[model samples]
Target: MAVLKKQLEDMRGIRYDIASLKGSISNLKTPTARQFVSPRQMMTNGKTPTKRSTPNPIGVGPSCISRKKPVRGNDPRKSAARTKARRRILQGKQISEDMMAALQMEDLKQLCSMHNVRYRGMPQARVALRKIPGLIVSDTEDLPNRSATGEEVQGANMEDAQSVESESEEEDDDSSEEAEYFEGPEASKDVQPSAH
Candidate 1:
């Protein structure tokens, strides 16, 4: 009878365990009033809920390429510098050496970009600025000096032509006089010696 009683107790325990197991299984099938993390979200290695590592690595890793994002436009600061440089170019103003020296190398590069100047790498700003003025002067040698305008050049040319024409007329008069001197014998030949 004791053995039967012990068996009954074991059976009751087993029944209790089965009931608990059934309850847990049912709860797993459909969790009640719980936050749902989708399968895609769970696949993202969910260690930190707030912070995630960015795809852009620190510095340039081996696999990484250019850091400048294509989506965003050019750096505004550089574009501003380029606009300033372009304005100066359109005005035909010389870039002052003092300003060139004061500006950063990047700013000078922006200036060069405005004028379509290309370089292998970052060149010396001062040297490039100095070269620009000389280039302007050399290329524009055909243009008359600032003091000599179109009217002044026309006046000078007119005066030169007048002087040349006057000089030529004077030479022709002198040549006519010399011809008279050489024609003395001819003039005598034309006159009869005497009406003998």
Candidate 2:
């Protein structure tokens, strides 16, 4: 009789658990009035949203900005130094020891650009700046001094171009001469003897 009574208590406990599970399932399927919240109120937190002047499809705000180019312009002091160097060249004057000593690495680079000298990978130091004048002098060696009418400058340009062409032609001739000297043996054609 006691065993049957314990089984009855166990069955009652299981039924109570099943009843609680069904109540929770019904509550989930049909939400209560307190669970229903308007989306506008939830998003804005019960406050009115601000209006936008334009539609931002990309979502990039105006506050996030960037510059495409450098803020600094070509340094005026560097330009003045280059002008001085050009004047010296026009006067048929050499880059003096005093002038060379005064210029910085940046000034040397500016001067190099003005004279069309390839300054890439060149050392950026006071001592290295000394070699730049030799390159400039070599480039402008054949150039004439400045004239009243500026015709000498134009003439100098033409002469420079002609000299460049002659150098290239000389190089081409040297290559052809090398090819002649290094000529390979010609292959002999294999002819079949007459079948007759």
The candidate that wins on lDDT is 2
RMSD of each: 25.0, 26.9
RMSD of 1: 25.0
Residues 143-191 of candidate 2 have per-residue lDDT tens digits of: 4455555655422566566699899888877776665665556523453
Model 1 ranges with Cα > 4 A deviation:
1-92, 120-125, 134-196
Error of 1 at 14 (Å): 80
Judging by TM-score against the true structure, name the best candidate: 1
Clashes of each: 0, 0
Pairs in clash, predicted candidate 2: none
**Candidate 1 C-alpha lDDT tens digits along 1-196:** 9999999999999999999999999878555687765555443576435556668767856664758556575656655655654555556655333334345566667667766676665555445556764323222233222333434231124545569989988887777676566667557555432221
Candidate 1 weakest ten by summed lDDT = 135-144
